[model samples]
Target chain A: MRPKIYLFGDSITEASFDDGGWGASLAHHFSRSVDVVLRGYSGYNTRWALHVLERVFPAVDSGGEGVGDGVVPLAVTVFFGANDACLPDRCSAFQHVPLHEYKQNLLAIVSFLKKRWPTTLVLLITPPPIDEEGRLQYPYVENPLGLPERTNEAAGAYAGACVAVAGECGIPVVDLWTKMQQFPNWEKAYLRDGLHLTQIGNKIVFEEVVTSLREKGLSLEILPVDLPLISEIDPNDPLKDFQK
Target chain B: MRPKIYLFGDSITEASFDDGGWGASLAHHFSRSVDVVLRGYSGYNTRWALHVLERVFPAVDSGGEGVGDGVVPLAVTVFFGANDACLPDRCSAFQHVPLHEYKQNLLAIVSFLKKRWPTTLVLLITPPPIDEEGRLQYPYVENPLGLPERTNEAAGAYAGACVAVAGECGIPVVDLWTKMQQFPNWEKAYLRDGLHLTQIGNKIVFEEVVTSLREKGLSLEILPVDLPLISEIDPNDPLKDFQK
Candidate 1:
């Protein structure tokens, strides 16, 4: 079976197969090398995600390596906190996960994945920065009060917590929150609806993910293409290269 | 685990994750509901593809049910014959398989897949109409003799054979060869090269595949969402609906 790289997250991750989505680009980049699996649940926060973690992934086994089905992923990306950063008093407060709980939930998810697939690379991605103005302009739901449900500062707090958790767990991190903010006019440029990514924003995430994976020795350059290239095939005996 | 839809084909399928490719659009369409697995080989013909068929798909098993891993794909799309349509005397003859062999190989593939997982929906996608004029305008390789390697008429023949195979096997097929030419100016509108698809062409394939799958009782409206919808969770006790 082809080695798999799983993308686990919320709405942003759910939309990662859309045109110009980071996940789609990653799938293209790793075509014939690794299967990029999307396990995103839109509108989900870290707390809500915990409930379905075991069902979505394999349970811990006594063998200490590989699942019972013998499908251990090469890497699993945990991208959460966007919904968790919602303010408690807002209309979307149901999705709000407390800061401490957010970190703990992420840690729990990473621990579960690591325990199940001992050698699987666990990478954490900080939620992209919140554009309060954009959120107010394009509210996902009717905002009678006309207030943003999520604040940039609150999201930053979650991003900070996310980075700290990665440090505690010794895994790679993609600090999208800080990275997107580094750009000028990011509110209009990187975001489509304050929370979701624009095509350009998706490219940024794709690049960062590739860079992080490359640093961790999973570069596209090193990964083997699944089958023989056309140039490798012997025209006189075409089946020579295809024989498994 | 989420059910999977496997895409098996040639170069066009290999490049299906590129910008505006049909496979990526399908993945987005089936996001969260099904995992779209790409098993495309860039220059593979139906004959060459047979050698790796068993490795790519599960071998025939006892009990006439799922494979050893208990993973039976929900659907598999067999999209080949583009390379096999190449004229025998052309510079690309190495990729050609005789018309009879082409049909037989497809029959063998469908038979193997059905025997392995009888319940899995097998769909065939006929090669798209070729544009011989466009092939010369943007030749894939040097054509010193200035002769097109493939002709629209020859491709139509292969497409016919593909459709016939699907009929014989009692499986659904997307007749891209006929469907694409229905539009005026399709040579430029649907195809980028004489062989590969443009973004609009990808959309056409995507729509046709969806329509065929829907006709076969795999409509998105009927497919279950993977997890609890945000509206299903109670605001007061969000975790209530998430319990397994």
Candidate 2:
């Protein structure tokens, strides 16, 4: 079976296959090497994601006869906290989880995945810095009160919590919140509408994710291509190359 | 488990997850609904592809206890014939298969898939129209003799055979050969390297595939989204909606 990489997150990850999405870039980068599987759920907070964890990655039988839920993934990225950071008093409060609960939920997720695929690499990605002005201009839904449902400050708290959880778990973390802020005019450059990523923003996430995997010895340079390259096949004895 | 759509073909299909690939578009289109799996073999022709088919789609046990190789896909696309269309007397002769063999191989593939997944929607895609001039300009390998390894005429034959095979099997076939030539400046517009696709070419394939699937009762409109939409969840009791 091909080694698989799972992207588990919310809307940000869910829309990662769009024209220039980070997920699509990952799929392209890992083409013929690792299969990238998206398990993103739009509008999901860490609390809601935690509720669906087991169903998404169900436990296999002790004997492993059934090979339940397909193969164990090589790595899984937990990229929630976007919706979790929504302002509790705003229109998007329904998707909000308390700051403390968000961190705890992420911890639970990492633990569950570790138990399921003991050796699988676990990576966490903090929510990107929000653009309050952009959010006001492009709300996902009708904002009758005309207030942004999320703020960069509120999202930073979730991002910090995500980093803290990653540190506690001894795994890698991609602090998108901090990374995006490092760029000048990031409000319009990295984000398309204050929350979701722009193409360039997607590229950054893709690079960060790849770098994280590379540091752990999963670089494309080392990963074997699935089949022999066309140039490798001898014209006279082609079948010989297809031998198992 | 999410429904899967498998793309089985040669290099053109292999590179379908590239920056502006049809496979990426498909994945984006089917987001939150079906999973698109790529099983493309670069530099592989029908003969070579047939040799590896069984291994790629291994048979499951009668009782189906293990889901031997995961869930059955909802649809599978058999896209080949590009490399097979290479001119027999040219440098790419090594990858060539006789026209008759190409048709027979496709028939066998369709038979095998139907037996394995009786209800699975099977779609065939013909090789796109080639540009002999473009082939010489952007040769994949060194061409000291300054000769094109593939020809538009040969590709048309292979595409015709592909369509015939699909007709014999009673499955839908994307006549990319004919469809591409219908464009006024197709030589440069559709094909990037005479053989592979340009962004617009990929978009065309994406649309054709979606249309074919739609005709067979698999349109995105009818396919239920995997989970509850955020709007559908009651803010007062979100968990109540996730009970399933």
Candidate 3:
């Protein structure tokens, strides 16, 4: 059974495999090694995520020996809060969830994964910092929402909430919110819009994710060396390795 | 359960999910409705594929009564012939397969999938035309192979064979070989190297793949309307839709 890396999140998570996407980088880096399952839900926040998470990732239903007991994935990345951090009681009113509820929802997700798919590693990524000024200059994809529907400060707060939850849950977290800002001229540099990641932003997350997963034993150096190379096997008996 | 579309092929297939990839395009187009599984094996020809195919996509073993009989995917795109059509008499002899054998391998793949995964539609994509001029300018990824290990004529022949096989099997085929060349200035515009696709090439494949799948009844217009929306469910009873 091939290993799978599940990416769960909102639009940023949704667009993780876009052109020059972080998810694409991961897929390329781990080509022939792992399957990167895209579970990105566009326009979703913690509240909606909480409701749909179970269907997307059902628990091991029957422990007493059943097909549902397929091997747990190698890792699951929960990347929410981008939409959740949209200023509650502000424009684009539908997607926003209060900061406290976002924290609680994240905790529930991490805790559920821990209890159900115990073997898989869970990593949380805080929403990247938003650019209110930059956003006002550009029309975000969710065009109906007014400019500055989300603010860096508000997103930063949710990012902090994410960190607190990750800290309490003992999970690895890629603080895109903080890391993206560490670079020079982050406002115009990292974000594609005030919301999504640019190529640079995606690469940062990709590198951090690979590094984090490697630390958790999913090494980048460990290519699928175990699989039989074509030339290594007799051309006439190609199926031998597979059959065994 | 989400419907899945499987992409199976060689290095080109392997890189299909890369940034701005056709695979990513498919994923984006089918977002929230379907999952696109990347089953790309690099430097592999149809002969190697024949042997390893079952392992990657095993037949529904003991369908009589078993959980292993999970839902078959909506479609599977078998894209080979790039490496298979390697000029056997010319350079880098490792990946070369005789024309007759190449045809046989294609037949075997289709027949096997038709019988094994009966429910899933299998679409065959002829490898894109090779650009000898571009290839000479740029050393192809398979560097051991000569500057022109493959040729447009050679690839086209295999593509014809592929079309013939598809016709005989009565299955859908994406004649990329014929379709790509239909445009003027095809080579410099589409192919990055003689063997692989550039951004334009990738987009063409993405569009063709989507169009063909839709023609086979998997329409792009259809959203996953069957699944319950978050708003439809009570926030306190998140698992309601999932359990049902």
- Tens digits of per-residue lDDT, candidate 3, A1-244, equal 5678889988787778778889888887887788788888766788778877767776445572211325577889999998888765565656788988999999999987877677789999999988887777775435554557888999999999999998998889999899988888888778877778888888999999999999888975764642565546554454565565
lDDT of 3 by residue, B3-69 (tens): 7788999878888878788987888777668878788887688987887776777544546221133
Clashes in candidate 1: how many?
Answer: 0
Candidate 2, position A195, lDDT: 89
Model 2 C-alpha lDDT per residue in residues A37-83, reported as the tens digit of each score = 87888899988888888666665655542224557788999999989
Quote fnat for model 3: 0.47
lDDT of 2 at A147: 94
Q: RMSD to native for every prediction?
A: 1.8, 1.9, 3.6
Q: Model 1, range B147-237, lDDT digits (tens) per residue? A: 9999989999999999999999999999999999999999999999888999999999999999998998787798888888776777788
- Total clashing residue pairs per candidate? 0, 0, 2
In model 3, which runs have C-alpha deviations exceeding 4 angstroms? Answer: A64-69, A138-147, A223-226, A229-244, B60-69, B140-147, B223-244
Candidates 1 onward: DockQ, in order: 0.67, 0.63, 0.44
Query: Candidate 3's chain A scores what TM-score?
Result: 0.88
* Model 2: per-residue Cα lDDT at residue B191: 92
Residue-wise C-alpha lDDT for candidate 2, range B14-108, written one tens digit per residue? 88888779998999888888888888888899898888887667665555422245577889999999898888887778898999999999899
- Residue range with the least summed lDDT across 10 consecutive positions in model 1 chain A: A60-69
2 against 3, candidate with superior TM-score:
2
Task: Tell me which residue pairs clash in candidate 1.
Answer: none
Instruction: Give Cα distance to truth, residue A144, candidate 1, Å.
Output: 2.2
| Candidate 1 C-alpha lDDT tens digits along A180-204 | 9999999889999898999999999
Question: Comparing chain B with the reference, what is the TM-score for each candidate?
Answer: 0.95, 0.95, 0.87
Badly placed stretches (over 4 Å) of model 2 are A61-67, B61-68
